[model samples]
Target: MRLFIRLLLIPGIVGWLLGGCSEKIDPKPATYSQLLTGTDKKSWKIVSYQVLDNGNASSVIPAQSGLDACIADDILTFYADAEHKLEVSQNAIICYPNEPDIYVTDTWTLFNANASLEFYLPVLNGKFPWTIKNLTATVLTIEYYFPDINASYRFTFNSTTTK
Candidate 1:
């Protein structure tokens, strides 16, 4: 009689303990800023850029006569402190390092809930505004609408340079 009662109590106690536990809590979603500058703080490179017109996206791959190979392999680094850098590997002394993995630093900032990505060239001659379309851990897609030209320039970048 005591053994039967013990078995019944054991099951109930086990169930009670299991029921008291809750499901694992998921990690909090990262903020817009954290999404750009990843936890590893790595640099990114532009995979492809397109100029859209009439809803059609045209590839702006810098393979034209004037654009060199190194120009196509630019890296962008964004920091949590609102400081950004554009490493123009084209100017490296080795001419073109195939994928242009050289070091250069420019400036960039996206602040105060504004989606404007004001990027200043290293030479400070020009600063372009690229609106943040989407930003993820692995991909960043921004667009520039030129009303003067009636064109929308969309640039897609990858977290790592696969070229």
Candidate 2:
């Protein structure tokens, strides 16, 4: 009888202790925006571009193409005519091997001048071994990697005001 009581009590105590120690996790919300540009005139140029980290470089878009730039508080917004109509948006938490606790949200709109269509894509930002940074004003560069596809891409932007 004592043995049976001891076994039952031990199990009950262990279960209660474990249950009480469990922690609750909260889900993070996604971010999205639909911004309207004001009358303030600004322009950006794709002066030079490169895909990935390769040494090769290309001209920023075409010469006659139109580019736009807008500033919103802490973030700068760039817009171009979406002939391709590609748009993407996503939210993700990154657990980088070297740097943890990194979180990012990304949205991209792709347009092809010849295709007369657009691509809208949203993906969770990933943390890579190489740090990703953004440079704005005269030039802006964004680096991203896709874990699902095992690929990475880079975009460069250049901005100038028309007098």
Candidate 3:
């Protein structure tokens, strides 16, 4: 009787241990807006900027495009609020001495089923639309075309913070 009881307990113990190792339920995937803004806000820093001609990478910024190096450290943040505020922080470096450290704009929208982002820049005095090439938890790629130059600029940004 003792041996039989021991065999029964061994199986029960093994089964309980295996049950504890089962996979946990996964949370739902985040939406585009959630990925862009995170829980409350998110900050992104440019990793690469390339100029495209006829859908080909012709040159890279700051090397052939004459873009300032200061732009690489800037942080673009989006807030998940009623206004959907957008802000850019010119960290440590600024292209111009008179430029402000932070630029804020309330006029921003995610349109075309959240496949595109449009934001108004007071300094530029116009609203610009960027095609959302890709947006993930860690990376965001957007493209903008300049009609006058007949070229497209692709910007890849890495998420600095997503909270």
Candidate 4:
């Protein structure tokens, strides 16, 4: 009886260990260029941008400290053709009715192999690299490395609420 019991237990344990080995993991990324720039062309807002240095969290800029009215109504729009735009609005108190709003158009791309984002700002001379932490229809999270500051900046975004 002991011998038979030992035989059954050995087979069961071996089968359990080898069961998952044959199954392969899919290498394709869940988030792609098509997903980032959806068909509807929805706009996204900067919900928050936090900087993590040595495991400490902090806001990137002074405006991010508080939802100052000056940069309150900022919106980002991304298109499928690798073009994006940032629309910035100033506080109504400071902005005159005839004052022109700020609109910045730039080129952006995603390297699917490494799951990183590259922004080619016309204003800037070089490309900015950002590793995508998470991406979805409603939210987008990215990490950027600032060599000068030696800190990793993470930016979180949420879909804008359209009127």
Candidate 5:
């Protein structure tokens, strides 16, 4: 009697928990066109930047921006100006790491490498924490958190033709 009732309850509870856990959460990336168009441009700003390892401990490179966009090959040139303590430095660096293992693909991968970290460009009057994921063209979704503070910006790129 009691054993039979316990068995029934156990199955019901287990099913309920599993069902709740099955919901998928997908976060998308913003598109290159959208970025160029400045559709959601207000969400970000070019604040004082730093080039550091993913651990946020070691400083690989300092701040100074003079990046030339090469949409043809998806490259950004980090020209070494006087601010960067150089004058005739003009070279293009791959936006992401060259290695497939370090670079993120179709999945959400996190790296703990010496020089791999997600950078956040500051936003004027921005006061929220957010995340970007599921990078697609049709959808750009952003979510916010407590005190309505947590906010996320999604970005996606179409072409690799940066030149």
Candidate 6:
């Protein structure tokens, strides 16, 4: 009876030790590109736009800057494709009723070691470049300099969807 009990205890201890040695699989961390475009696409909405003077915040959006309230409803989406497509949509409230809901479809590029971005701006009729200040799974911040005004503008966006 003592020998049989020892045999059963040996198998249980061996099994427990084997289970402890098993490897755990963890999901891979997302890359910078993946954070911007998610698996295939990502949508973002403007949270705050700030005017910086000499690296200091001078003014804010809406009341201070007199920015149209409708601008907050706009959605910007980035697609992970060969062209790096971008789409801007006027969501909820349309700033300009005469304009279409889909405001613009343009190509975007990430350069400067993925620290900067360049995209077409229909309003300016030229390519606009911005420095990527910060990017995370839920937030993105970008800065643009206006040489004429001698000021920098920072735009912060909140992620609406990662699809």
- Cα lDDT tens digits, model 1, 31-134, are 76677776535566666667698778775653222234454444556655544544444433344455435445566677537676777432223668879888
**Model 5 poorest ten-residue lDDT run:** 82-91
Number of clashes recorded per candidate = 0, 16, 0, 0, 27, 0
RMSD of each: 5.6, 17.4, 5.3, 10.2, 17.7, 4.5
Report how far off residue 29 is in candidate 5 (Å).
Answer: 2.6
Residue-level lDDT for 124 in candidate 6: 32
| Top candidate by lDDT | 6
For model 5 the TM-score comes to 0.22
Query: Lowest summed lDDT over 10 consecutive residues: which window, candidate 6?
Result: 60-69
lDDT of 6 at 83: 80
Checking candidate 6 for backbone clashes, the offending pairs are: none
In angstroms, the error of model 1 at 2 is 27
Residue-by-residue lDDT tens digits, candidate 2, 114-144: 2111112122122232222444334445555
Quote the positional error of residue 111 for candidate 6 in Å.
1.7
Which is better, 3 or 4, measured by lDDT? 3
Segments of candidate 1 deviating more than 4 angstroms: 1-26, 54-56, 59-67, 82-103, 112-114, 120-125, 161-163
Assess the local accuracy of residue 118 in candidate 6 as a C-alpha lDDT between 0 and 100.
83
Worst 10 residues of 2 by lDDT: 30-39
What would the TM-score be for candidate 3 when compared with the true structure?
0.68
For candidate 3, write residues 1-163 as lDDT tens digits: 8897789988899899999999999899998888889989998777767778876785555421344556666677889887988887777666556767785455468885758888643323356898899999999888888878768877777899978
Q: Write the per-residue lDDT of candidate 6 for residues 1-163, one digit (tens) a residue.
A: 7887789988889899999999999999887778888999998887777888866786557422345557667788899988899998888877779988888898788885858888653323467898889989998888888878768877777899988
Q: How accurate locally is residue 99 in candidate 3, as Cα lDDT from 0 to 100?
A: 64
Q: Which should have the higher TM-score, number 1 or number 5?
A: 1
Computed on alpha carbons, the lDDT of every model, listed in order, comes to 0.63, 0.34, 0.76, 0.63, 0.29, 0.79
* Count of backbone collisions within predicted model 4: 0
Specify the highest-TM-score model's number: 6
lDDT, residue 82, candidate 2: 38
